[model samples]
Target: MITVFSLIAGMLLTGMNYLVYRQLIVSFLSKKTGLVCISVITICTVIYISGLRIVELPDFLYKTGAVCLGLSFMLFVITLFYMAGKWLFRQVSLPVNQRKRRFLSLCFKGAIVGAGAGYVSTGIYSGKSLPRISTIPIKIANLQRPLTIAQITDIHLGVFLQKDFLQAIVHLTNEQDPDLVVITGDIIDMPPEAIGDTLDPFGQLKTRYGVFCVPGNHEYYYGVNGILARLAQLGITILGNRTKQIAGINIAGVYDLAALQLQRGPFPNLEAALETRDPALPTVLLAHQPKFIEHVTPDHRIDLMISGHTHAGQIVPFSLLVLLDQPYLHGLYHHDSITRIYVSSGAGFWGPPFRCGAPAEIAVLQLTEEHRSASFLRK
Candidate 1:
C-alpha cells in the first residue's frame, strides 16, 4: 500500500515538473502546450491525492504532509512571481525603460515575499542547538585530556553567502577557540576563478590545531584538485582519503561519495588509514557524506564520525527524500557500542539562495568521558 502511494506521489511530482517546464517554455513558445501541461498536472495531482490513504497517516507524518503542502504552495507562488516578471519584461531591451521599471518593482515585491518565506521556513525547520550534544560521553582510553573540535560543513559560499556572512561564521567559530576546526566540504558552488574574491573571507578563520577539509560533490563538479589547492593556500589541510593527528587524536578524512564513485575502485580505505594508529586511541573521521558510515564497523574502534551532505534536505518534502537515502540523515546516531556519528545539516544553502526547511549550522563537539557501570548480571 505504501509503495503504491509513493508511486502515485512520484507521478504527481513528475507531472508538476512537466507543467512547470511547459510554463517556462510557453513564455517563448505556444499557449497550447502550456494548457496541455497544466491539464496533465491537474489530472496527476487529483489521482495522486485521491489514491493516498491520508486518513491512516500517523500524527507526525500528517503534520509533515501539511508542511509539504505549504511548501508546494510557496513554490507555486514563487513560480508565478517569476513568470509574471518574465512576462512584464518580455519586450524590454534597454536598461532604462518603462518595462524595466515595472520589472524592478516586481523584483522588490518578490524580494519582500521571499524574505518572509525564508524566515518562516527557517524557523519551522530549525532545531535549536542541534546536532545536539549527547550526554552519553565518548570514551577514548588513550587520550590523557579532552579535545575541543569545531566542525563547519557545507558552507556553500556562493550566490547567497558573501563577505559579511563569512565574517559572521568566522566570528562564531573563533568564539569557541577550538583546538581543531574541521570543514566537511562544499566550500563553493563553482571554481575559485568564479568566486575567488567572494571566498577571500574564509581565509580569516583561525584555529590553533589547524583547519582541515575534504572535498564535497560540488568541489568535484567544479574541480576537486584545484579547489583543494585553493583551500590549501588559505591554510586549510585538504585530507583526500588521508589521516592526520591533532592533539593526540587521529583524524581521518575521505573524499565525497561522488569522488569515490568516480574512482570505481576500493578507494578511501578507512581501515588502512587508521591501521597505524592505536585502536585504543580516540579517532575522529571527517567524511563529507554521511553515507560512508554504512560501510564502517563499530569494532574498528572509531570514536566519532562527523559528516555533512544532506543539508537536512534543504527544503520541505525533500527532507523526507534525504532521510530515505541515508540511515543517519541529521544529528548523532550510534551504529554499535563504540562508533558514534554526527551528521550536520550544513552551514549554507545550495542551488536556491533561500534556505527553506534547514537553517545554516556550525557544530561544536566537545569530547568527554562516559561513566562505566561496575555491576554484572547473570543470565
Candidate 2:
C-alpha cells in the first residue's frame, strides 16, 4: 500500500511540475535550458518525496527533501490557480500580450515563492520552538471541580520531530501544571528500530494524574506492539479501548482506525471500555481521529472527546481537502447535545516540518461545571 501510494503521488507531482514548468517557467527561457532545468527538478522532486517513505536518510537531508517537496507542491497549486484566473480573464475577452502575460506569470510565481518561504519559516519556527498553549474551556455535567488537561497529539517523533523538540514540548506542558496529560495519537512516525532514544523525553513529562495515550494510525504503520512496548517502558499507559479512573472522571480511549485496517488487532470496543464506568461520572474519550465521532451515538455517555490527525490540513488550501473527509478539522466542536470534541492541529508535523496558516498547538482542555453549558451550546 505504501509503495502504491508513493508511485501515485510521484506521478501526480511529476505531471504538475511538468505543467508548471511549461506554462510559467519554461515559457521565459530557451527551450534547451528550460528542458534541462525542468527534467532535473522533476527527477529530484519525485525521488526526494518517494524516498522519504522508504529510506532512512540523515536528518539534514531528510528535512531539506521534505521542504523541497512542500515548496514544489505549493508552487504547483499556486500556479494552477493563476492559470485558472488567466483563463477566466481570457474568456471575458481580456487577452494579454506576450510581454504582459510573461510579466503577470512572473509576478504570480514570485508571490508563490514568497508564500512558500513564509510557510517554511513558520513551519520550522512552530515545529522546533515551544508550542503555543491553546486553552479551551468546556462544560461537562457531574464534574465536581474544574480539571485542566493538557493534550499533545501528532508529535510524529521521526526525522522532523526530534528528541530536542520533544524535550521542549515536555517542558512547556509541565509548565502549564496540568492535572492530567493526554496523548491522542501519532506519537511517532518512525519504526521502533529507527526511533532510537528520541522518545526518551516523554519520561520527563509531568502531570498530577500521569500521562496516558491512545494509538494513532502511524503507530500501526510502525507496528503497534512495538510502540506499546516502548510506551510501557516510558511509563506511559496505553489506553486501548479501556478506561482509567483519574481525578474521579472516567478517561476512555479507543484504538486507532489503522489497527482495524491493518488487521493488527480488534477495533476499539467502546462498549467494553464504557460498560463499567459510572454513568454519572464525567467521561472523556481519547480518540486519535476526529472523524471517529461519526460512529458516536446519543446513548454514549461520553462528555468530551479529544483527538488529532487532521493537522488542520497542515497547509492552507489543503485544509479544504481535509474538510472533505473530516467533519471537524481543529479546535472545539460540539458533535451533539451531550458530546463535544476538541481536535488539535498537532504538536509536530508529519512531512515538511512547516505549518502554513494552521499553527501547531498544545491543546489545554479545562473541564468546568455545566453552569456555562447553555452559553456554549453548538449552533
Which numbered prediction scores highest in TM-score against the true structure?
2
TM-scores, each model vs. reference:
0.65, 0.88
Candidate 1: which stretches are off by over 4 Å? 1-14, 17-141, 263-267, 370-379
Q: Write the per-residue lDDT of candidate 1 for residues 1-379, one digit (tens) a residue.
A: 6567666765765555555555543543477876665555445444434334333344344334444444443445455665676676676664678898778766756674676467556645552223222222344556657777788888776544556676777778877777788899887866666666666666877777889888787887667777788878888887776778778788888777886656642246676667666555588888888888887786767778889998887765468778788777776676667777877878776544344556667877767664422221011
TM-score of 2: 0.88
Off by over 4 Å in 2: 27-38, 52-61, 88-128, 370-379
Give per-residue CA lDDT, model 2, range 1-379, as digits (tens): 8788779988988888788787656645787887776676677667777676776677766666676677666767667765776676566743358888778667856765676567567656664565688888888888978899999999888766688888989988999999999998898988887777888888998888889999899888787778878887999988888888889799998998877777887477788778777777889999998888887887896899999999988877789999898888887877888898889999888876667778889988888884554443444
Query: By summed lDDT, which 10 consecutive residues of candidate 2 come out lowest?
Result: 370-379
How many clashes does each candidate structure show, in the order listed? 0, 2
